[model samples]
Target: MSSLYDLAGPADAGAPGPSDPSDPSDPSGARDVVAFARVAAAAGLGARWPGQVALLGPGAAGAAAGSLLGGAVEPASLDLSAVLDRSAAGGLVDVEFDDAAAVRAGLACGGRASILVQPIGALPPEVLSALAHRRPTAVLTRLDDPALPTRAPAPPGDPAYGDPDSPDSLARSLLERGEPADAVAETASGRMLVSVYVPAPHLVVVGSGALATALGAQLALLGWSSAEVTGLDDALAAVDALGPGDGVLMVDHSADVDGPVLARALRGGVGYVAALGSRRTQAARRERLRAIGVDEASIERLRGPAGLDIGSRTPAEIAVAIVAEMLSVRASTSGAALRDTTGHLNAGRP
Candidate 1:
């Protein structure tokens, strides 16, 4: 990253953003992450899409990521127990992870030793969203601690290995390979704590208008991506244009038009479907949707008010709440910024 220009030549150059000067919500620092990653990938490193996972544990996180590389390429562990030095492809780097170090290095936690896994390519959509918005995410990693009785924890209904509390071996391996698994689990006995600083959730906001614009700016800070989709037809078309793991947020809901768009979106297997409207308007729309067989479950995920219940007044505030809700539901957790605490965590990786 010292000479990022040597990487991809600016990706079209808009000034390497360090988003704002002091705002923790700025996306600039996040850009540093992307630049370094892209450079590494361009250099032919073993990093790739969805970004990378920075494991927090002993040699665990490193071993986990290296294992994820697949094929027969085993990760070389440079335990701090040895002197740090430069070598060929199989060289070693001396480093140590701790609570204070986590904050300083932006790894995960202070007390835990971690592996900072960074994808060598474009980060996963979720990580990108988190970066753009400056939100915290939960990550799970394993422990060599003797406190746990040595049994793999039950799969917490989440494919992310297990809960972000304790990650299973499979989760660590996948994360190392650059696939973004939602949760990670260790087991019933392992030390459990979620790594935070996950990128914000992204929402492709289709349709242009006051709402779209307002939402875009607001979501940008809430750790959500708010892209504008102009019309119902355009929105529907965009849905088809999306790849797997993409999410959409639609505004300007005209029953006759948006309803069909919603149907197409649902059928397309989009993750989150939301529209903006007044209470009465949303209720009536729901009734009509059921009449057309849109189903109660999908309808339930639909946020009529489209935001957390913070009683936001301005369009900007409302937009914040909406994007916040999108992130909450996307992670399947209640709304609470992850930066202030150290309970659950996930690293945004390739």
Candidate 2:
């Protein structure tokens, strides 16, 4: 039998294997996604769609609910049982959906969707692991355009090819931008699809107060994860739990709690650190941090009274405001109203 990647030479042909995600040097975790997409494209699988194979899974409404195969033998027509069969042999297939047929199936509420079919093992283990852990990642896919070369001469944003100053590395740029989600862009090479995976921010609330509880519940509603640290001694471990994009909410307000916790957070490189307090309180905290040897720059990073100026009164309202501020910081936005911002709304986006 011919291999799925036969058209692309071999899976590990002359091309370089994907970089190790465990390597601390490659923190983006996009290398595997790029490698797999490249393989699929070279193999001419889903040539039009590049890296994906769609399956007509649930939420598909229409008249032809049972005719999922659409009387076709293409990979997309494979049913659940067939998919299981293919997986047993390490096969990947694409399932296409016909909206009209679905509408005819007498299903009024379900919508049409194509599922990307593949064995769990076919995917890069690193990408899967990162997703399981809610780490921030981006998947950059280059389309097969007859007009363009088979491979891009250089990674986007690289200094190669006479433009050392160009910061066009698509993967890096995407990582620098907003929440991980699907985005499209036209590049010098061709059109590209970027599937960004921004794991929900894990909020570390360093307090057992009502505000901390409310914040945890609110984060849950947003599908974000939160770790609550009630005691001062536990603050360090909680602060250490934060990854690159995670945040620290110091609502505990006790110098005993905030002092060591804030110092550790600043030193450890948490994305956001905010304490609940007034201006005078923040000043005092700053002084305390300095005495503990926390530098001025790190002290400056703290957002005391952490929240937007929406005039929050209750604990719930405060939670909303603080979360909003953290989100704004994460997105690198000023938290201003969208109506007030000018220029292409998605200028920096893919």
The runs of at least 3 residues in candidate 1 whose Cα sits more than 4 Å from the true structure, single-residue gaps closed, are 1-169, 172-200, 222-224, 242-246, 336-350
lDDT of 2 by residue, 27-135 (tens): 2232222112112212112213222322222211211111222222233234433543433322233433354543454333223333323332333444444443335
In candidate 2, position 30 carries an lDDT of 29
Give each model a TM-score: 0.45, 0.59
TM-score, model 2 to reference = 0.59
All models: lDDT? 0.44, 0.54
In model 2, the runs with Cα more than 4 Å from the true position are 1-91, 100-135, 139-168, 182-195, 337-350
| Top TM-score prediction, candidate number | 2
Overall local distance difference test of candidate 2? 0.54
Steric clash count of candidate 1:
43
